[model samples]
Target: MENKLIVSSSPHVRSNQDTSYIMKQVVIATFVTMVGMLLKAYIPALGDALGLFIPLIVVNCLILARAESFASKNTPIKSAVDGIGMGLGFTLALTALGVVREILGNGTLFGMGLFGASYQPALLFILPPGAFLSLGFLLAGFNKLKNKKA
Candidate 1:
């Protein structure tokens, strides 16, 4: 097997490394980022602010998707870069989503009250159902822009 020349499907170049090996490397590289998120989660000033969403980025679909789609076929450095971009993108999107949900559900932004105490929060936005609905809408909007750009 070591002497064999393995072929990959069209357009993508290949290496002898298996999927598991590439995935492991990608995961290891991204682990550094996951730790930073955990650290932020423990930090007082920011923990309660956005910590809840930080750690979850480790398993974010964006990162995993990039790892499987790009890392498995690319060089280590490129894979690492892809992972970094995906990681940052994932975190940023989540942060924005959290902000939107927080503002709409609690009438607050960055823990600071918005629209005053008189403002009533939309209780649904804070709930799981609303979260999924919000995510769906966001994805739809993103897809629209992406298709238009393409």
Candidate 2:
């Protein structure tokens, strides 16, 4: 009788420290930078409206929070997709808030009047505190619906 031993040829350890992750990071960073530049160059009106806020996106806490928590734990591709989803979520939230404020405060949607000329727009809804009130109501509505479903 003879004794024999065999070993399989495969990686025994898994690691995140790899060229693929590094390249993905680089690609995502470059794409974000390019998008910023394009927004500034092509959307002059928006650039003017937002002014320095555009540049402030680099230091935006929403982005930083996701990067620090989600991106750090997830794979590179997943992190990138999550970043996009977060952005869309943010956009939808802001747009909803803006629409609510506009309709209540100005009686207009995208500058088109929805109410009769005799209707009075609520000035209080246009002020800074109005943002807080609108957001609170929106959140409350969402919570009510969520609880109902649950």
Best by lDDT: 2
> Which pairs of residues have clashing backbones in candidate 1?
none
Q: Write down the RMSD of all candidates, one decimal each.
A: 10.0, 15.2
C-alpha RMSD between model 1 and the true structure: 10.0
lDDT of 2 at 98: 87
Candidate 2: stretches off by over 4 Å:
1-59
lDDT of each: 0.68, 0.70
As a TM-score, model 1 comes out at: 0.54
Q: Where is model 2 poorest over a 10-residue stretch in terms of lDDT?
A: 1-10
